[model samples]
Target: MGSSVAGLIGWRRATRICKTFLFSLILTTASGAVAQADCRADQVELRWPGGQARFSVELADDEAERARGLMHRETMPRSAGMLFAYETPRRAQFWMKNTLIPLDMIFADQQGVVTRVHSNAIPQDTTVIDGGDGVQFVLEINGGLAKRLGITAGAELRHPKIASSLWACDVE
Candidate 1:
Protein backbone atom coordinates (compact mmCIF):
# COMPACT_ATOMS: atom_id res chain seq x y z
CA MET A 1 0.00 0.00 0.00
CA GLY A 2 2.64 2.58 -0.98
CA SER A 3 5.23 1.18 1.35
CA SER A 4 2.70 0.90 4.18
CA VAL A 5 1.81 4.55 3.94
CA ALA A 6 5.46 5.59 4.00
CA GLY A 7 6.13 3.52 7.07
CA LEU A 8 3.19 5.07 8.85
CA ILE A 9 4.42 8.55 8.17
CA GLY A 10 7.86 7.72 9.46
CA TRP A 11 6.44 6.42 12.68
CA ARG A 12 4.46 9.53 13.28
CA ARG A 13 7.43 11.73 12.71
CA ALA A 14 9.55 9.76 15.12
CA THR A 15 6.92 10.01 17.77
CA ARG A 16 6.72 13.74 17.39
CA ILE A 17 10.42 14.19 17.82
CA CYS A 18 10.43 12.09 20.90
CA LYS A 19 7.74 14.14 22.48
CA THR A 20 9.52 17.36 21.74
CA PHE A 21 12.77 16.27 23.27
CA LEU A 22 11.05 15.06 26.35
CA PHE A 23 9.27 18.32 26.78
CA SER A 24 12.43 20.33 26.54
CA LEU A 25 14.23 18.14 28.98
CA ILE A 26 11.51 18.53 31.52
CA LEU A 27 11.51 22.26 31.32
CA THR A 28 15.22 22.55 31.75
CA THR A 29 15.23 20.40 34.82
CA ALA A 30 12.37 22.27 36.36
CA SER A 31 14.05 25.61 35.93
CA GLY A 32 17.18 24.40 37.61
CA ALA A 33 15.27 23.36 40.66
CA VAL A 34 13.51 26.66 40.84
CA ALA A 35 16.78 28.50 40.65
CA GLN A 36 18.32 26.44 43.40
CA ALA A 37 15.35 26.72 45.69
CA ASP A 38 15.02 30.43 45.24
CA CYS A 39 18.55 31.09 46.38
CA ARG A 40 17.23 31.84 49.86
CA ALA A 41 16.66 35.61 49.78
CA ASP A 42 20.12 36.63 51.14
CA GLN A 43 21.74 39.95 52.17
CA VAL A 44 23.33 40.07 55.62
CA GLU A 45 26.10 42.47 56.72
CA LEU A 46 26.63 43.06 60.45
CA ARG A 47 30.01 44.74 61.13
CA TRP A 48 29.71 46.16 64.69
CA PRO A 49 32.19 47.92 67.01
CA GLY A 50 30.83 51.36 66.34
CA GLY A 51 27.92 49.98 64.37
CA GLN A 52 26.59 48.85 60.98
CA ALA A 53 23.61 46.64 60.40
CA ARG A 54 21.41 45.35 57.66
CA PHE A 55 19.67 42.04 57.54
CA SER A 56 16.84 40.69 55.43
CA VAL A 57 18.10 37.13 55.44
CA GLU A 58 16.48 33.68 55.51
CA LEU A 59 18.69 30.82 54.42
CA ALA A 60 18.50 27.83 56.70
CA ASP A 61 20.69 25.79 54.29
CA ASP A 62 19.02 22.36 54.50
CA GLU A 63 18.70 19.47 56.91
CA ALA A 64 15.02 20.27 56.51
CA GLU A 65 15.68 23.96 56.77
CA ARG A 66 17.84 23.58 59.86
CA ALA A 67 15.27 21.46 61.62
CA ARG A 68 12.58 24.03 61.04
CA GLY A 69 14.04 26.96 62.95
CA LEU A 70 12.00 30.02 63.87
CA MET A 71 9.24 27.53 64.39
CA HIS A 72 5.88 29.23 64.46
CA ARG A 73 6.89 32.80 63.83
CA GLU A 74 4.42 35.21 65.34
CA THR A 75 6.24 38.23 63.98
CA MET A 76 9.86 38.77 63.01
CA PRO A 77 10.76 41.85 61.02
CA ARG A 78 13.08 44.30 62.63
CA SER A 79 15.08 44.18 59.44
CA ALA A 80 14.38 40.46 59.46
CA GLY A 81 16.72 37.44 59.74
CA MET A 82 17.30 33.68 60.07
CA LEU A 83 20.49 32.22 58.70
CA PHE A 84 21.77 28.88 60.13
CA ALA A 85 23.96 27.42 57.36
CA TYR A 86 26.42 24.81 58.63
CA GLU A 87 28.65 22.49 56.69
CA THR A 88 31.67 22.35 58.96
CA PRO A 89 32.62 24.59 61.92
CA ARG A 90 30.49 22.74 64.47
CA ARG A 91 29.56 23.53 68.12
CA ALA A 92 26.47 25.58 67.39
CA GLN A 93 23.33 24.92 69.41
CA PHE A 94 20.00 26.73 69.79
CA TRP A 95 16.54 26.31 71.13
CA MET A 96 13.42 28.37 71.64
CA LYS A 97 11.21 25.31 71.47
CA ASN A 98 8.27 26.15 69.26
CA THR A 99 9.77 29.56 68.66
CA LEU A 100 6.90 32.08 68.64
CA ILE A 101 9.03 35.32 68.43
CA PRO A 102 11.86 36.77 70.59
CA LEU A 103 15.24 35.74 69.13
CA ASP A 104 18.81 37.08 68.64
CA MET A 105 21.21 34.18 68.27
CA ILE A 106 24.03 35.43 65.98
CA PHE A 107 27.12 33.16 66.31
CA ALA A 108 29.29 32.90 63.22
CA ASP A 109 32.81 31.91 62.21
CA GLN A 110 33.82 29.75 59.29
CA GLN A 111 35.10 33.14 58.34
CA GLY A 112 31.87 34.96 58.89
CA VAL A 113 33.49 35.91 62.23
CA VAL A 114 31.15 37.06 65.05
CA THR A 115 31.59 33.88 67.17
CA ARG A 116 28.70 34.37 69.60
CA VAL A 117 25.94 36.72 70.76
CA HIS A 118 22.91 34.91 72.23
CA SER A 119 20.94 37.84 73.74
CA ASN A 120 17.15 37.96 74.35
CA ALA A 121 15.96 34.50 73.23
CA ILE A 122 13.07 33.82 75.64
CA PRO A 123 9.87 33.01 73.75
CA GLN A 124 8.89 29.45 74.20
CA ASP A 125 12.37 29.22 75.67
CA THR A 126 13.55 25.64 75.55
CA THR A 127 16.90 27.11 76.72
CA VAL A 128 19.90 25.31 75.07
CA ILE A 129 21.46 28.24 73.08
CA ASP A 130 25.16 27.40 72.99
CA GLY A 131 26.99 28.42 69.77
CA GLY A 132 30.47 28.08 71.24
CA ASP A 133 33.29 26.26 69.38
CA GLY A 134 34.17 27.20 65.86
CA VAL A 135 30.48 27.66 65.16
CA GLN A 136 29.45 28.19 61.52
CA PHE A 137 26.81 30.84 61.02
CA VAL A 138 23.53 31.08 62.95
CA LEU A 139 21.96 34.55 63.03
CA GLU A 140 18.34 34.83 64.14
CA ILE A 141 17.76 38.51 64.98
CA ASN A 142 14.86 40.58 66.39
CA GLY A 143 14.75 39.87 70.13
CA GLY A 144 17.02 42.67 71.30
CA LEU A 145 18.32 43.18 67.81
CA ALA A 146 21.65 41.85 69.04
CA LYS A 147 22.08 44.36 71.82
CA ARG A 148 20.31 47.03 69.83
CA LEU A 149 22.55 46.60 66.80
CA GLY A 150 25.98 46.37 68.33
CA ILE A 151 26.02 42.66 67.49
CA THR A 152 29.12 42.02 69.62
CA ALA A 153 31.71 39.27 69.88
CA GLY A 154 33.95 40.55 67.11
CA ALA A 155 31.03 41.08 64.72
CA GLU A 156 31.30 40.85 60.96
CA LEU A 157 28.90 38.63 59.03
CA ARG A 158 28.14 39.73 55.48
CA HIS A 159 26.64 36.52 54.09
CA PRO A 160 26.49 34.18 51.05
CA LYS A 161 27.14 31.23 53.28
CA ILE A 162 30.63 32.30 54.17
CA ALA A 163 33.03 30.45 51.90
CA SER A 164 35.67 32.19 53.99
CA SER A 165 33.33 35.12 54.00
CA LEU A 166 34.53 38.36 55.53
CA TRP A 167 31.67 39.90 53.63
CA ALA A 168 31.88 38.03 50.31
CA CYS A 169 28.74 37.66 48.19
CA ASP A 170 28.97 39.80 45.12
CA VAL A 171 27.28 37.14 43.05
CA GLU A 172 28.33 33.63 43.91
Candidate 2:
Protein backbone atom coordinates (compact mmCIF):
# COMPACT_ATOMS: atom_id res chain seq x y z
CA MET A 1 0.00 0.00 0.00
CA GLY A 2 2.83 2.38 0.89
CA SER A 3 4.69 1.73 -2.41
CA SER A 4 1.51 2.23 -4.41
CA VAL A 5 0.86 5.48 -2.54
CA ALA A 6 4.40 6.66 -3.32
CA GLY A 7 3.88 5.79 -7.00
CA LEU A 8 0.65 7.81 -7.05
CA ILE A 9 2.41 10.83 -5.55
CA GLY A 10 5.20 10.60 -8.14
CA TRP A 11 2.65 10.48 -10.95
CA ARG A 12 0.88 13.50 -9.55
CA ARG A 13 4.18 15.45 -9.36
CA ALA A 14 5.02 14.57 -12.97
CA THR A 15 1.58 15.69 -14.09
CA ARG A 16 1.95 19.00 -12.33
CA ILE A 17 5.28 19.65 -13.99
CA CYS A 18 3.84 18.86 -17.38
CA LYS A 19 0.94 21.19 -16.82
CA THR A 20 3.24 24.04 -15.81
CA PHE A 21 5.41 23.57 -18.89
CA LEU A 22 2.38 23.52 -21.16
CA PHE A 23 1.01 26.69 -19.60
CA SER A 24 4.29 28.51 -20.01
CA LEU A 25 4.55 27.47 -23.65
CA ILE A 26 1.06 28.71 -24.37
CA LEU A 27 1.71 32.03 -22.69
CA THR A 28 4.90 32.56 -24.66
CA THR A 29 3.14 31.80 -27.93
CA ALA A 30 0.30 34.16 -27.12
CA SER A 31 2.73 36.94 -26.30
CA GLY A 32 4.49 36.49 -29.62
CA ALA A 33 1.21 36.56 -31.49
CA VAL A 34 0.18 39.72 -29.73
CA ALA A 35 3.45 41.35 -30.67
CA GLN A 36 2.99 40.49 -34.33
CA ALA A 37 -0.60 41.65 -34.38
CA ASP A 38 -0.06 44.91 -32.51
CA CYS A 39 2.99 46.17 -34.37
CA ARG A 40 1.30 48.39 -36.92
CA ALA A 41 3.05 48.66 -40.27
CA ASP A 42 2.38 52.40 -40.56
CA GLN A 43 3.86 53.43 -37.25
CA VAL A 44 7.32 53.91 -35.77
CA GLU A 45 8.10 54.94 -32.24
CA LEU A 46 11.17 56.58 -30.78
CA ARG A 47 12.20 56.94 -27.17
CA TRP A 48 14.82 59.35 -25.92
CA PRO A 49 15.99 60.46 -22.50
CA GLY A 50 13.50 63.28 -22.19
CA GLY A 51 10.48 61.85 -23.95
CA GLN A 52 9.06 59.74 -26.75
CA ALA A 53 7.52 60.35 -30.17
CA ARG A 54 5.45 58.41 -32.64
CA PHE A 55 5.21 58.88 -36.40
CA SER A 56 2.86 57.61 -39.05
CA VAL A 57 5.40 56.15 -41.44
CA GLU A 58 5.46 55.10 -45.05
CA LEU A 59 7.96 52.30 -45.58
CA ALA A 60 10.54 52.50 -48.34
CA ASP A 61 11.60 48.90 -48.05
CA ASP A 62 12.51 48.14 -51.64
CA GLU A 63 15.02 49.60 -54.05
CA ALA A 64 12.44 51.48 -56.08
CA GLU A 65 10.54 52.73 -53.09
CA ARG A 66 13.71 53.90 -51.35
CA ALA A 67 14.99 55.65 -54.45
CA ARG A 68 11.73 57.47 -55.02
CA GLY A 69 11.34 58.57 -51.40
CA LEU A 70 9.42 61.77 -50.81
CA MET A 71 10.62 63.24 -54.06
CA HIS A 72 7.44 64.96 -55.12
CA ARG A 73 5.34 65.27 -52.00
CA GLU A 74 4.60 68.95 -51.49
CA THR A 75 3.09 68.75 -48.07
CA MET A 76 3.39 66.15 -45.32
CA PRO A 77 1.60 65.98 -42.02
CA ARG A 78 3.56 67.10 -38.98
CA SER A 79 3.45 63.62 -37.47
CA ALA A 80 4.03 61.79 -40.74
CA GLY A 81 7.35 60.37 -41.95
CA MET A 82 9.10 57.86 -44.16
CA LEU A 83 11.15 54.92 -42.94
CA PHE A 84 13.87 53.31 -45.03
CA ALA A 85 14.77 49.79 -43.96
CA TYR A 86 17.92 48.41 -45.48
CA GLU A 87 18.65 44.78 -46.07
CA THR A 88 21.82 45.12 -44.03
CA PRO A 89 23.71 47.75 -42.08
CA ARG A 90 26.03 49.87 -44.18
CA ARG A 91 27.24 53.41 -44.74
CA ALA A 92 24.22 55.54 -45.65
CA GLN A 93 24.40 58.65 -47.78
CA PHE A 94 21.34 60.62 -48.82
CA TRP A 95 20.78 63.59 -51.05
CA MET A 96 17.95 66.10 -51.32
CA LYS A 97 18.09 65.69 -55.15
CA ASN A 98 14.39 65.69 -56.04
CA THR A 99 12.88 65.74 -52.56
CA LEU A 100 10.44 68.62 -52.45
CA ILE A 101 10.15 69.32 -48.75
CA PRO A 102 12.79 70.08 -46.17
CA LEU A 103 13.50 67.09 -44.00
CA ASP A 104 15.25 65.92 -40.86
CA MET A 105 16.98 62.61 -41.32
CA ILE A 106 17.38 60.31 -38.34
CA PHE A 107 19.82 57.49 -38.90
CA ALA A 108 19.78 54.37 -36.76
CA ASP A 109 21.91 51.29 -36.43
CA GLN A 110 20.96 47.62 -36.68
CA GLN A 111 20.05 47.61 -33.00
CA GLY A 112 17.58 50.44 -33.70
CA VAL A 113 19.61 53.00 -31.78
CA VAL A 114 20.02 56.46 -33.27
CA THR A 115 23.49 57.14 -34.62
CA ARG A 116 23.19 60.46 -36.39
CA VAL A 117 20.74 63.25 -37.21
CA HIS A 118 20.90 65.64 -40.10
CA SER A 119 18.50 68.51 -39.58
CA ASN A 120 16.65 70.78 -42.00
CA ALA A 121 18.06 69.45 -45.21
CA ILE A 122 17.32 72.00 -47.90
CA PRO A 123 14.83 71.02 -50.58
CA GLN A 124 16.43 69.73 -53.81
CA ASP A 125 19.89 70.70 -52.60
CA THR A 126 21.61 67.57 -53.98
CA THR A 127 24.22 67.58 -51.24
CA VAL A 128 25.25 64.25 -49.79
CA ILE A 129 24.23 63.91 -46.16
CA ASP A 130 26.35 61.12 -44.80
CA GLY A 131 24.96 58.97 -42.01
CA GLY A 132 28.34 57.27 -41.41
CA ASP A 133 28.60 53.49 -41.16
CA GLY A 134 26.46 50.67 -39.81
CA VAL A 135 23.23 52.46 -40.60
CA GLN A 136 20.38 50.03 -40.95
CA PHE A 137 17.50 52.48 -40.94
CA VAL A 138 16.84 56.07 -41.96
CA LEU A 139 13.78 58.10 -41.03
CA GLU A 140 12.79 61.29 -42.84
CA ILE A 141 10.43 63.69 -41.16
CA ASN A 142 9.51 67.35 -41.47
CA GLY A 143 12.45 69.69 -40.92
CA GLY A 144 13.38 70.55 -37.33
CA LEU A 145 11.10 67.90 -35.88
CA ALA A 146 14.04 65.98 -34.48
CA LYS A 147 15.29 69.06 -32.67
CA ARG A 148 11.83 69.91 -31.42
CA LEU A 149 11.26 66.39 -30.11
CA GLY A 150 14.79 66.09 -28.61
CA ILE A 151 15.55 62.93 -30.53
CA THR A 152 19.24 62.32 -30.89
CA ALA A 153 22.02 59.79 -30.58
CA GLY A 154 21.17 56.86 -28.28
CA ALA A 155 17.46 57.24 -28.91
CA GLU A 156 15.79 53.86 -29.25
CA LEU A 157 13.66 53.22 -32.35
CA ARG A 158 10.90 50.63 -32.39
CA HIS A 159 9.40 49.14 -35.54
CA PRO A 160 8.61 45.62 -36.58
CA LYS A 161 11.04 45.78 -39.49
CA ILE A 162 13.85 46.33 -37.01
CA ALA A 163 13.70 42.60 -36.20
CA SER A 164 16.15 42.69 -33.27
CA SER A 165 16.45 46.07 -31.59
CA LEU A 166 17.06 47.98 -28.36
CA TRP A 167 13.30 48.53 -28.16
CA ALA A 168 10.98 46.10 -29.92
CA CYS A 169 7.24 45.69 -30.34
CA ASP A 170 7.30 42.53 -28.26
CA VAL A 171 8.60 44.43 -25.24
CA GLU A 172 5.82 47.03 -25.11
Candidate 3:
Protein backbone atom coordinates (compact mmCIF):
# COMPACT_ATOMS: atom_id res chain seq x y z
CA MET A 1 0.00 0.00 0.00
CA GLY A 2 2.82 2.41 0.87
CA SER A 3 4.61 1.69 -2.42
CA SER A 4 1.42 2.40 -4.37
CA VAL A 5 1.00 5.71 -2.53
CA ALA A 6 4.64 6.71 -3.33
CA GLY A 7 4.08 5.89 -7.02
CA LEU A 8 1.01 8.11 -7.15
CA ILE A 9 2.93 10.96 -5.55
CA GLY A 10 5.78 10.55 -8.00
CA TRP A 11 3.38 10.59 -10.95
CA ARG A 12 1.72 13.72 -9.66
CA ARG A 13 5.12 15.42 -9.29
CA ALA A 14 6.10 14.39 -12.78
CA THR A 15 2.85 15.75 -14.22
CA ARG A 16 3.38 19.03 -12.41
CA ILE A 17 6.89 19.32 -13.79
CA CYS A 18 5.66 18.69 -17.32
CA LYS A 19 2.97 21.33 -16.96
CA THR A 20 5.55 23.82 -15.71
CA PHE A 21 7.84 23.16 -18.65
CA LEU A 22 5.01 23.55 -21.16
CA PHE A 23 3.98 26.82 -19.60
CA SER A 24 7.54 28.10 -19.82
CA LEU A 25 7.72 27.22 -23.50
CA ILE A 26 4.55 29.13 -24.24
CA LEU A 27 5.75 32.17 -22.34
CA THR A 28 9.10 32.14 -24.13
CA THR A 29 7.45 32.07 -27.54
CA ALA A 30 5.11 34.91 -26.65
CA SER A 31 8.01 36.99 -25.37
CA GLY A 32 9.95 36.46 -28.57
CA ALA A 33 6.99 37.52 -30.71
CA VAL A 34 6.54 40.70 -28.72
CA ALA A 35 10.21 41.55 -28.97
CA GLN A 36 10.26 41.15 -32.74
CA ALA A 37 7.23 43.39 -33.13
CA ASP A 38 8.81 46.06 -30.97
CA CYS A 39 12.16 46.01 -32.71
CA ARG A 40 10.59 46.82 -36.08
CA ALA A 41 8.13 49.41 -34.88
CA ASP A 42 10.00 52.64 -35.66
CA GLN A 43 9.54 53.82 -39.23
CA VAL A 44 11.99 55.33 -41.74
CA GLU A 45 11.00 57.10 -44.91
CA LEU A 46 12.46 56.69 -48.42
CA ARG A 47 11.78 57.60 -52.02
CA TRP A 48 11.32 55.16 -54.86
CA PRO A 49 10.24 55.59 -58.46
CA GLY A 50 6.67 54.74 -57.53
CA GLY A 51 6.54 57.30 -54.73
CA GLN A 52 7.74 58.04 -51.22
CA ALA A 53 7.49 55.12 -48.78
CA ARG A 54 8.10 54.34 -45.16
CA PHE A 55 9.96 51.38 -43.67
CA SER A 56 10.82 49.98 -40.30
CA VAL A 57 14.54 50.39 -40.70
CA GLU A 58 16.74 48.18 -38.63
CA LEU A 59 19.52 50.73 -38.47
CA ALA A 60 22.96 49.17 -38.12
CA ASP A 61 25.42 51.70 -36.76
CA ASP A 62 27.30 49.07 -34.79
CA GLU A 63 28.27 45.40 -34.88
CA ALA A 64 25.38 44.05 -32.84
CA GLU A 65 22.61 45.66 -34.93
CA ARG A 66 24.40 44.76 -38.15
CA ALA A 67 24.73 41.12 -37.06
CA ARG A 68 21.09 40.85 -36.12
CA GLY A 69 19.73 42.69 -39.20
CA LEU A 70 16.21 41.47 -40.04
CA MET A 71 16.61 37.83 -38.98
CA HIS A 72 13.58 35.66 -38.14
CA ARG A 73 10.96 38.10 -39.44
CA GLU A 74 7.88 36.25 -40.70
CA THR A 75 6.69 39.14 -42.85
CA MET A 76 7.95 42.52 -44.00
CA PRO A 77 5.61 45.32 -45.02
CA ARG A 78 5.72 46.21 -48.71
CA SER A 79 7.07 49.65 -47.92
CA ALA A 80 9.32 48.55 -45.12
CA GLY A 81 13.06 47.78 -44.88
CA MET A 82 16.15 47.71 -42.71
CA LEU A 83 18.63 50.49 -43.45
CA PHE A 84 22.26 49.90 -42.59
CA ALA A 85 23.99 53.27 -42.22
CA TYR A 86 27.73 53.64 -41.91
CA GLU A 87 29.92 56.67 -41.32
CA THR A 88 31.64 55.95 -44.63
CA PRO A 89 31.22 53.68 -47.61
CA ARG A 90 32.85 50.27 -47.29
CA ARG A 91 32.49 46.90 -48.91
CA ALA A 92 29.55 45.16 -47.22
CA GLN A 93 27.98 41.75 -47.57
CA PHE A 94 24.66 40.33 -46.38
CA TRP A 95 22.95 36.99 -45.91
CA MET A 96 19.43 35.88 -45.08
CA LYS A 97 18.66 33.40 -42.28
CA ASN A 98 15.28 32.76 -40.69
CA THR A 99 14.06 35.68 -42.81
CA LEU A 100 10.78 34.41 -44.21
CA ILE A 101 10.36 36.88 -47.10
CA PRO A 102 12.72 37.52 -49.99
CA LEU A 103 14.24 41.01 -50.37
CA ASP A 104 15.96 43.47 -52.69
CA MET A 105 19.07 44.99 -51.21
CA ILE A 106 19.92 48.54 -52.35
CA PHE A 107 23.37 49.82 -51.63
CA ALA A 108 23.94 53.60 -51.56
CA ASP A 109 27.05 55.68 -51.63
CA GLN A 110 27.88 58.45 -49.15
CA GLN A 111 26.05 60.88 -51.41
CA GLY A 112 22.95 58.63 -51.10
CA VAL A 113 23.00 57.59 -54.75
CA VAL A 114 22.08 53.96 -55.29
CA THR A 115 25.35 52.11 -55.93
CA ARG A 116 24.18 48.52 -56.33
CA VAL A 117 21.10 46.36 -56.15
CA HIS A 118 20.68 42.69 -55.22
CA SER A 119 17.19 41.53 -56.05
CA ASN A 120 15.21 38.54 -54.76
CA ALA A 121 17.36 37.33 -51.92
CA ILE A 122 15.98 33.88 -51.11
CA PRO A 123 14.65 33.35 -47.62
CA GLN A 124 16.77 31.32 -45.18
CA ASP A 125 19.69 31.53 -47.60
CA THR A 126 23.19 31.74 -46.13
CA THR A 127 24.85 32.71 -49.37
CA VAL A 128 27.19 35.67 -49.02
CA ILE A 129 25.44 38.29 -51.20
CA ASP A 130 27.88 41.01 -52.12
CA GLY A 131 27.40 44.79 -52.34
CA GLY A 132 30.51 45.68 -54.27
CA ASP A 133 32.59 48.91 -54.23
CA GLY A 134 31.41 49.80 -50.68
CA VAL A 135 28.48 51.99 -49.61
CA GLN A 136 27.43 54.21 -46.76
CA PHE A 137 23.83 52.98 -46.70
CA VAL A 138 22.13 49.67 -47.49
CA LEU A 139 18.35 49.32 -47.79
CA GLU A 140 16.60 45.96 -47.79
CA ILE A 141 13.16 45.96 -49.37
CA ASN A 142 10.58 43.41 -50.48
CA GLY A 143 11.96 41.28 -53.31
CA GLY A 144 11.42 42.64 -56.84
CA LEU A 145 10.15 45.96 -55.54
CA ALA A 146 13.34 47.65 -56.64
CA LYS A 147 12.85 46.59 -60.24
CA ARG A 148 9.10 47.14 -60.21
CA LEU A 149 9.51 50.69 -58.93
CA GLY A 150 12.49 51.38 -61.18
CA ILE A 151 14.69 52.15 -58.21
CA THR A 152 18.06 51.48 -59.76
CA ALA A 153 21.65 52.62 -59.56
CA GLY A 154 22.09 56.42 -59.36
CA ALA A 155 18.65 56.91 -57.76
CA GLU A 156 19.11 59.48 -55.02
CA LEU A 157 17.84 59.28 -51.45
CA ARG A 158 16.21 62.43 -50.04
CA HIS A 159 16.65 61.74 -46.36
CA PRO A 160 17.64 64.92 -44.60
CA LYS A 161 20.24 63.09 -42.59
CA ILE A 162 22.06 62.29 -45.80
CA ALA A 163 21.71 65.83 -47.09
CA SER A 164 24.52 68.26 -46.47
CA SER A 165 24.06 71.59 -44.60
CA LEU A 166 21.20 70.32 -42.42
CA TRP A 167 21.27 71.09 -38.70
CA ALA A 168 22.70 68.13 -36.84
CA CYS A 169 19.85 67.66 -34.34
CA ASP A 170 17.12 68.73 -36.77
CA VAL A 171 18.13 66.33 -39.53
CA GLU A 172 15.95 63.28 -39.81
In terms of TM-score, how similar is model 3 to the real structure? 0.64
Better of 1 and 3 by TM-score: 3
- The Cα error of candidate 2 at residue 48, in Å, is 0.7
For model 3, how does the per-residue alpha-carbon lDDT over 1-172 read when each residue is reduced to its tens digit?
9999999999999998787556334323323332233212244444444344345555677788888888888887665688887777789888888778899998887767778899999999989988987688788888987775566776655343454231111322
Which candidate, 2 or 3, has the higher TM-score?
A: 2
lDDT of each: 0.73, 0.84, 0.68
TM-score for each of the candidates: 0.27, 0.76, 0.64
Number of the candidate with higher lDDT, 2 or 3: 2
Regions more than 4 Å wrong, model 3: 1-56, 163-172
Please write out the lDDT profile of model 2 over residues 66-151, one tens digit for every residue: 99999988999877899999999999999998888999999999988999999999999978999999999999999987886677
User: For all the candidates, what are their Cα RMSDs to the real structure?
Assistant: 16.8, 19.1, 14.4
| lDDT for 18 (candidate 3) | 86
* Deviation of model 1 at 62, angstroms: 22
* lDDT, model 1, position 95: 87
Q: Tell me the spans in candidate 2 whose CA falls farther than 4 Å from its real position.
A: 1-37
